[model samples]
Target: KRYSSEKSHIQGTSKLALGIFDGMKKIHGMGARERLLLQIAVLLHDCGKYISMEKVAECSYNIIMSTEIIGLSNWEREVIADVVLYNTRDFDTFEIMKQRDGMDKRTYLLVAKLVAILRLANAMDRSHYQKIQGLRVVLRDTELQVILDSARDLTLEMGLLRRQSEFFKEIYGIYPVLKRKRNA
Candidate 1:
């Protein structure tokens, strides 16, 4: 499904997503399966944007739900779809849980983690320029600081991340701080 210049966008988002996951995995104790799921979800998170911009995330959720990818199992497809749905915007996690049914607490928790990671990672690539090269994440008691290694000014990313980070903060209980990598 991922190919060409579009593939690079996937690649860029994947890099950021994995970086964020890796940055937090130890602190959060993320399992390998969930990490792989996060990687797959990020890779395909934007596939629907190509078809319609107005309903990009919803479209992405529809596409992933209907189409079966090679490596993803049926439930994995469902999980990815949920991730795609939440990654598209700053949706309130509590509000979402209230609206949906049949999801147990564990599923809700996993979705929360996936969406938190995807939200911040997707927000970093908001301009689609992939201006962010790499990053280092340091977690304090209740804050996650992401120091980006980028050549371009991150005004756009910082602004967007701030807007989109509330969901992440709410779910993870950690305020996310985005900034440039300081001189060594």
Candidate 2:
């Protein structure tokens, strides 16, 4: 609330992301620590938009690194910051990330996974309208089908989801498909 002008978007996106993380926890091999980082990253992801919309990712990274969030070690903060940093930017491959400073292989992969989830959640609320009333995420074979329950038109959200799905597929080996439930 202090940094984000679009509180609904932040809240909605956080809800969606946490839900996704929870649903995929077993398959994704992410536990409580990753979930905590994901939550914090989603919360502060757009805080940089408070400074510059065009450079939100960079600005958010700077802001998060500068702030001393309690209970988080410097490394944990870096994980969250990088997650926010890559929210809009295309993530580097694992080898490219290995050459970067600060994060180890485990942490780097964690950041990438969180970034993937955050990007998809952010896309679901791109209009900041919270059009999706409910959703059920299911991993079926090679697809992560997000069955949405909403009466509103979702062309924008669906299109953005399609665009974001590639990264998700690259990270998880499962394509994300958004399907509107017929009766809902």
Candidate 3:
């Protein structure tokens, strides 16, 4: 059933990606090129799902590292794979950012940024149903509130917001609270 689903219907990841992009733009002032790159990362974050759930991360990594989809360069494909692998909960951002004894700083920072955005977007769609209809941001002096509007009850939505808000907090240093519109 999952494989047969329409691309539009399977858009939870993209929606959340856009939300993160919007958040980054508003809070961190990310420019057009940066936003475009982040958007690409977000769009391809779930391409792994097409392979298998068990070790889907590894599958995605292999596919990105091997494929020439959309004519992306070898380095660009490597960046995609790195982002997918590091998006896991076990990976440490600081350790990755260190550049080790010989790793490249440019690659480390680039992958870190991609993983950060992917983490937030993946959390937003905890249900993987694309249930969230839209998201809005209200920036306060000390807090940033993200309002999520859904077509149905959002018991799962609230939980996702809690988990995903960590990324927002880390990126912007602003408190994030999720609010749903009351039934009228």
* Candidate number with greatest TM-score: 2
Candidate 3: what lDDT? Answer: 0.65
Q: Which candidate do you rate higher for TM-score, 1 or 3? A: 1
Q: How many residue pairs clash (N, CA or C atoms closer than 3 angstroms) in each of the candidate models, in the order given?
A: 0, 0, 0
Decreasing lDDT order of the candidates = 2, 1, 3
| Candidate 2 residue lDDT tens string, 1-184 | 8885577887899889998898786589988988998999988998998899899999999999999999999999999999999889988776777677645788877887898899999999998999988888998999888888889989999999989999999888999999889897
lDDT of each: 0.80, 0.89, 0.65
* Model 2 accuracy (lDDT, Cα): 0.89
lDDT of 1 by residue, 94-128 (tens): 55665674565677778778888988888898788
Q: Per-residue lDDT for 173 in model 2?
A: 90
Query: CA lDDT of 183 in candidate 1?
Result: 62
Model 2 RMSD, rounded to 1 decimal? 1.3
Better of 1 and 2 by lDDT: 2
- lDDT (Cα, 0-100) at 166 in candidate 3: 71
Which portions of model 3 miss their true places by more than 4 Å? 1-10, 94-103, 182-184
